[model samples]
Target chain A: MKLINILSEKKEIVLKKWFDKIAASYPVNAPSFLKNQKNQFANPVGYTIEETIEAVLDVLINEGTDKKAQEFLDRFVQVRAVQDFTPSRAVDFLFMLKQLMKDELKDELQEKGMYEEFLLMESRIDRMVLASFESYLKYREKIYELRVNEFKNMAFRLLERANLTFEFKDDDPAFEKDVSDSDNVK
Target chain B: MPNESKSDELKQDELVKIDYKPPKKDWMDTPVHFRHGTYIYPAKAKNLTYLGLPNPREWSPADEDWKLPDNWKDIILNGMKERLDKYRSFKVFMDICVRCGACADKCHFFIGGGDPKNMPVLRAELIRSVYKGNFTAAGKILGRLNGARGLTKDVIKEWFYYFYQCTECRRCSVFCPYGIDTAEITMMGRELLTLLGCNVNWVIEPVANCYRTGNHLGIQPHALKDMFEMLLDDIQDRTGVKIEPTFNRKGAEILFVTPSADYFADPGIYTCMGYLMLFHELGLDYTWSTYASEGGNFGLFTSHEMIKRLNAKIYAEAKRLGVKWIIGGECGHMWRVMHQYMDTMNGPADFLEEPVSPITGTRFENAKSTKMVHITEFTADLIKNNKLKLDPGRNDKLRITFHDSCNPARAMGILEEPRYIIKNVCNNFFEMPENTIREQTFCCAGGAGLGTDEMMEIRMRGGMPRANAVKHVHDKHGVNRLTCMCAIDRATLSTLMEYWVPDVKVTGIHELVANALVMKGEKERVVDIRGEALKEKKGEDNVR
Candidate 1:
């Protein structure tokens, strides 16, 4: 049997381990709130990570590097991207999944002489990691862009009120359009 | 050459290192300097003059001279003396603090910013120290050693920085042994600061606008009608239901008022749609006021006199329109004013009867003095009576949680009303952690007129506690949306949610209610109020 099949069978164990690893990165007080709480309402963030990771794992087993995998991976990576994680740490969760799978499935793969398939799986996860890194960068850049846009909007309102500028009007559709472009006048 | 390379590496390391260096002079000893990313721009001369606020002058917060009146110091001292005598709670809070430090860690701003002054105790101490020197004999003799200091220009600057940073969420009051509310202290501090023209533009401008045009946005009657027309069009496009709401019509039995942001801004506009649909369904005899268009009082951030002046219009309009009672919309500080200060400031409100929901027949005894019911209380009662049909599956796409607006929860204790409304409408719902919700809830970190983006760094820091709590729920419950009642929360928490938990979107509670309302003769629902597609493939994983 292939490593993907074995991995798919033991997906629950692998996912629990992966969830714990990602959650452990938060401050010590954060984990009980993020990991230990079973009530989904009380702990939605923990539940989302588990659900999202499971979906991503299914796509990896069924169809590697496909559109479905990209979609699922984007949802998962975007969470970390907007969090307090540095860029390297944001995508680190993707790489950890491979190590977790290899460690969890070590004996079964060796017994079936599926070690080569396991190596292929590792390379596949590496590709997933690369994709996630790109996704994280895009989301992080969006955050920076949003901060700039917020500043421009705030500056325009303050300046308009102070009568220093008459170029912008509140609630004007045209004013909101390309506010970054309007910064040149300032 | 090796030494030069090592020095270059050291310089690079220093460049990236986050600095938390205390200024060379003690913050208490040093005159508080206005730092960029901390202070707000000054209120305009015209805005101040329009509102009849004191010291109506063109002075920037960043400028060296604020152009204070000649007797500014005396005015502040005498103002404190009058207020201390008038308000027993303010006097008790000023005198009774043991500085136990329990409240220091309780504040979201203190936890997030790590600024010692952001601590509720020290923030109050900024004023208390002056109060001591001016009022007490021991303070006159002991001076700085007894934590009493003479009020000076630097002290006024300190009051401006620290008081505005407070959202008046009252989290600190929850932990204090004597129940000393920092909000009361912050209000008093702001009152004293405003005595010297030390008010921010974000607040004074709104006060002026609300005073003149009946709304903080200064939206005129014609423009207000045009905006409502736009919402009517959007609602028809999304839900195939046309709602006709009356503006400034007399003898309507009820007068509905909301923050001006609801009419003009995103997310809030969606909540306004929720109110319109609900009101239209009931065929309630209510009229919207173009005159008392605002429920939010930014004067709450300015001074008590200004709060009273702006709030007077609500009761004044209600009396003129001959409405039985009022129904206020989703707003945070607005409710704070209405619940705690409005009746005292602008009442007897004896012209209006106790608010009885026309649909549910529930009497809102909590607002008996003010005779105004919060929309959440109105709707929650309606849901309890099975007055409106709801389709929870329409909101299947969202896993939701509620952020209790600090004022509503702490001030009015209207905790369960919004939650009851959310539970009845939406199929998927979650609660934030016990410590971060209800009366113990954290501020959006940008409440009390500090929501401007100029102070993004400090705002982010202040938001960290709430953001951390939000991040917890988002990770645990697959929660994608946060719903709140306050207009400030709707505006500011959006940025906080976007920054820390990007996947989660902030929304007003009524928006969720509207999505699940199941209106009569509505076309097969396809999109939500925002015109975003509702999840079509339901019954896949109900999970509930």
Candidate 2:
């Protein structure tokens, strides 16, 4: 397969998971918040929903696109991982979007008598998309690890040719077992 | 008749000897005491060679194969003249100095030899006259009036000889109120001479060889390793101390350093042995890097870029070893390059931890943490802090006088450190007169790459002043031993002392200290009046 086709396929998988999470947190009363034609009335609920989706896209694209930006995000993620940030933070991001939209649209919804019904529908969709986004973030980490391992292998080969010695800890069980068996035979 | 024939045969042998003695009454007669005996005539001619004013008729045009361009002579003359003018300091010094002669007596050579040309002002005038004739309109118009002559083969020879005579000691500048540095003028003259392909074979050949190989001695890595191993064995045999001089060991706590010459030549290896023994005795963690082993920068004799290239290895090796500090062995220009120029050229070291003496717990105040240290200072501090158990009586009967090297004393202000170490180790110590010590000291005449046999006449003439001072004390106080800190000074002065005054001996200060070091269970390590080892074991087999 062409390299670009493979990259695009992987990017589509990542983007779909992100877009579904945003759609799930969409307000049921978003149309009401967008009303009052020719008036300067604040549409806080619609604005909140848009801003949250934009922030998530900014984070995802910053990590997934620009090479330097991705490296920086990887470094940040590694540091956060050391500090024990779990994969469940993706669910918390969805819940924050819902809370902001509810608070913003409550006054207008109350005037229309539709506040309780809209919140109930919005929350049910949030759970389904949050689960998918969490799994996508885990898959992104795996891809990063594979690329780093390939780079390290090339560096080791070059260093060997230069007559420099570098020994790493035996982390791969199969490779370690093979080396130990060869040593025993020798 | 047969006896008469035997007498005739004896007479023929006597006749062949031909009383080649001087005339009874001569015009060039020196005082009876001043007469130099058998070697005096050759020695006088040698002194005259240092004046560097050759006879013009000796010049011979080159053969066709190596013949210079027809206009090459003129081109060189004009180029040098223009360069002399462009140098602001040189121009200022040439035009400004009145014949006050305030700097006359200040030069160690002048005071020692009593030669007028050895005076700083007169020595500078030799080159300045050539400058004036070529550069100035007045000088060109009235050549005889300005004492400038046309550029000739004779002038080229004179430039080679006299310019090399100046050691670039910078002692004369101290007495100049206008602060005219004669050393700078000497450098310019030498540089111009080099451009005309006129360089002393001894200095230039070694420089070329060093460029090809990594060291002045032209010893490659294998030879260097072998020499170090040999010296290590010799050290163990001599001092009964086994020292493993580790090579290229990464993450060693310190880097044991020495001049590259030590890895190849004599007296240098002895000093290297001294360093190894001291390090071993202290039980310090250090390693030798073949890469950064050369401490002496020959480039300092020629150009700045060469200096940078030679010195680049030290810090690179320091980074490679992950060491805390670099400890340099006993060398002259090595310390000068490290103490003066290294940081400015290859610095801002981030990896180095600030040095606090392991024994004393006192920090070096003005020193860069990563830069360098003279081994004398390090060892002296150890002795001062009561870390090294030394017995002063070990050096008894070795009446010693110290000759300060120009670079270390004048350039680095390293006067007291070596002296302190020497005094602590030796029971009897003497310093030269105050004027001849420290910053005011004269060079051993073979400094600045002028240490060659072809230049021996000039070297001795230049060193006559220093030799005379040493003779004065030797005559008065019976002081026979001269201890110096610089390797060049030791090498040059040893040659000079052998030829000029054979009664005295010259040796490195570390050699004296190493000789005097009190080994475990040895009562003393002193040399008796006759220069015999007094602490020899009974029935010990003599190897040499």
Candidate 3:
């Protein structure tokens, strides 16, 4: 299948699992919480789920192993920073999901001896996302600094390039001597 | 017996002597309308404010401090003198006035207040006296001897108030054999007052603001874009018409124009939306420009130089945009400036092509020759040519009487265009008395810059005559709706209606047209995309 379709299917499964875990933990008003989705969900980021998923799939299209997949996940955090979504908000959302999973699936994970492995995966994802978010912030700050410096340089250059002239006084003795010399020459 | 008879004859002679004594009552003692009377002061006096001056008794030479630069003054004065000399029609009318009172009863103020001084001629004389005092040697010396006052700060203040009251309506001039225009005198007076920095704070402040910002209401470009987006959303909600109000669209076929006031202020924006929707329905290629957006020239309130400066951008923007014709909005002075002075100031624009109605293929003659057209005229022409589908029944209860704005009717002879459109769309259309109907109509008391709360009493007194005539029809024939072509007239008259005659409502002619025009089934009138209609609908629903 296409890389976009595979990514989209993965995103759907992950989102559903995340929501199910939350619902199982917070059972009292889980349905109401799920119904009141934000504008981002209603409008969606791209034309279709596949199109949005394609952006992530591009990083791992020709990957040999899980390293490239991990790298693609790390780049997701960078893309989020460029989109101006808060890194803290993303971290909070991830923590909420982890809490939900702990409450709902802890027993099952322990029985399967997969709890430590899942914890390690979560830690790796957290480090990758944080590093990428910091880089994006630095990039924006550097751009702002460059613009201010360029503007100051331009202003100074404009001042230097402006026309300048000197006015000589007619009453000066030197000016009188020059006039007299010119008249004699003529 | 002979002595008694002699005494009786002496008594009779005493009675005759008593009869000959000069009547004690001067007509001014119980003046019919105190508002219309000129509050005369000493000619040489400083600020003696009768008309809303803050410190009326104080005499300050602060006006002198605000004097124009020498070069600017020279240019302005020379340009004015040249224009005065060049405008042959105005000169002819000014020179030939015989002071006949045929137009005296034509004034709404005179009719309403029963003030003889409110007569258009006597009001014109107030300025004429000053003109004679300053311009001529005989007038300078003899004028003071004959009750003329030298132009002073107080006089300037008075000019600002009274001239603004005149509404530049040429209704009186229509009746005069000489066609003596009060609007010209009002314009001259406003120009002179502006030189003294005596402009109304409300008006001049906005004009200055317009100069600084793109629009008169000081709406910035980014804010305007946001507002348009909001309006577009509203349009979609109301009529399901998904259209964008094109901003700064360069190289459009037509420059879709309206007064900047409409975009910024109420009732105006509603009408603007209507225009936008109509244009959208027709699928016309047009764009709105922030640079040349303002149709109402406040410079027309002050000087010709100001008028020229304000109008300079219009033609330049049109040429830059490569548009064929500029379609002006429902503004009185805008149309007047466009119809009368735009070509004269800008000159024969050879670059623009003539405007043609896209649907009908009927060519608008002299569109390039003339730089602008009044929206009403354009719409009326289209309706007359049977280009638009209109249902008169939609305006079943609307009994509209058109009050021809002074500038368009008297100054530019634009009378029938609005009337034709009104009649076409509205079934219960009524014309006022023949004299008051077309060119001979009275001012709405507050025109020019005179529409102030302080001047309300005077405005009412002036509008009294017009109100009396309107009331006459209202009482007898059930004519409750007062429709006018001028935005200033709408502003002033609507205020008058709210206070003096609450029975009648004043609205723009376009508002009525927009109301009555046939729309597709369940498709709301696209005229007011600002969601004003939704509010009205909520109000109606509440009532129901």
Candidate 4:
């Protein structure tokens, strides 16, 4: 029996554990709300996490790559990034998959003499943590950029009120240049 | 250089809190602070100019001088006088408030952001104070003692800050003893602010887009067609069903108009797919018009006249395409305008008969005057009449909850229609807390053009109330999905839920409907509408 074969057979348990681990990072009350629904709308955050984990597992088992899982991963981490989590704490959920898989499938892997393969899976999880960290940083930067833009727009608005800087309507030719210049208005 | 104190830097997790204090000085003496997350960037000059709005000169909320014309005060005061006589509701609302403070605790912004200005009564006071000082005789005699103060530039700035902060959800109106809707007050305040050329870019840009391209996204007819075609491809790949929807086709019985965001964006696109599949399932004769692509009117956020201008196209396109009536897809403020304001603003839609759901023969008395039916009402009627084949088990994996959008619940009383459809389509449907679900429901925290990215901090803060309720239900009943009928809810609630209630996600009611609808002769369906693979049927996968 191969490691991939065992994973394929017990993917449901693996995915459920993965989803539970990620959801547990939320406040204690939120996990119960997140876990009970098999429905997507009822447990959307959980559903998204479950789908992402499942997609990741499928790619892992088949030795294939899927961009969809990364997209889901971005959403998962982006949410955490905006929360009270620090950078490391935000991306920590990605690493839980390794422990969860090792615990759930340890017996099967050892009995099937697939110890090396388990280590390989650990490396894959390690790589995912890095990817997720990058995503988390990107989201954090975006949030900071937005704050700076708000400040600049406000400063310029006040300047206009003080009759310091000039103002341009959208139709003015200067408007295009002003809006397109260095400041991130969008 | 002086040594910097440790408190000079804000903690990573600590959000800034600006507390309201009773001033030692008079209300008129206090200066305005255009704080981030509370104020919005002013409307671009072109958008205002394109619509021929007054004072189209470029202005920013951050500016010290707004570049107002010398006669600006007179212009606004006269505008108020004209509006007082023209719209009796505005006058009645202005005179009715008794400072009971009942509506203060009712607003979600106050609950989430902890800003006293977010309190409904005070938000109303930002403008009501002006109305008193300028319009009423008591204000003239009593002044600040009687809650009346002269309208200064600071007062105008305060109006821009607080009015834009409101989502116009009307939850406060539900609590007001006199039924003095804060939304009506906010609309009037926003209208007055527009007279100062002080509109937000997020709103005015959408209004300009809707006016010029017949959609809020400024999508051309070719781009709109391409989007629909791309969705068709995705549908084929996911469900193995090829659905061809008619676009701008003449002589169609119904003109189906949805928010342009549905045609272009995620989560909304899935809902759009749901609409296409549901329509195809019913074999409904409807035409999609690129010329009238937007069901939402951002102009509602600007002024009534602008709303009327943006809305005129719906009936005009309906007539041109020879559609007897219109069926609106899921949207929020669009419904508010259609249900409460459309007929009066641009009606006598007498050329079209009352909209009867063709499948169920249910005549929508609520929409009889406008000759428009909401898609949820249409679907609920169909389910009630047993018109379509449904397999609730297809949604067995979902434990869903319905979020009554503020406009539909408060403005249109569309509380039951969506719940009826959700119950029929899914097996595990739970309601949020009693206070948080219906007419008393909290806003998605991002509506009325406050849904922009720059406002994310306030949006998240404002979402706290809705998220708290969702957390309560999610913990108590194990509910995870938050279903809403509004397009803005679908777009913004996803971000809100992700930030506040990390375990919950959002979807449109129609998306779940499409998930459960068992199309005739369809191939084995493996994945749901969002392209998530469904669990294999028991004992079937192994046998295969």
Scored by DockQ, the top model is 1
DockQ of each: 0.05, 0.00, 0.00, 0.03
Of candidate 3 chain B, the 10-residue stretch with the lowest lDDT total is: B39-48
Task: List, residue by residue over B348-367, the lDDT tens digit for candidate 2.
Answer: 66676666566677576556
How good is the docking of model 4, as DockQ?
0.03
Error of 2 at B477 (Å): 3.2
Best model per lDDT = 1
Positional deviation of residue B407's Cα in model 1 after best superposition, in angstroms: 0.7
Give the per-residue lDDT of model 1 (tens digit) for B22-66.
Answer: 234455765655666667778787887777667888887677777
Deviation (Å) of B319 in candidate 1: 1.1
Which candidate wins on TM-score?
A: 1
Candidates' lDDT values, in order? 0.79, 0.57, 0.56, 0.79
Q: Candidate 1 chain A, which ten residues in sequence have the lowest lDDT sum?
A: A155-164
Q: lDDT rank, highest first?
A: 1, 4, 2, 3
Question: Residue by residue across B342-407, what tens digits does model 3's lDDT show?
Answer: 788876777777777666676777455784666776787778777776656555565667777777
Kindly indicate the candidate among 1 and 3 with the higher TM-score.
Answer: 1
DockQ of 1: 0.05
Better of 1 and 2 by lDDT: 1
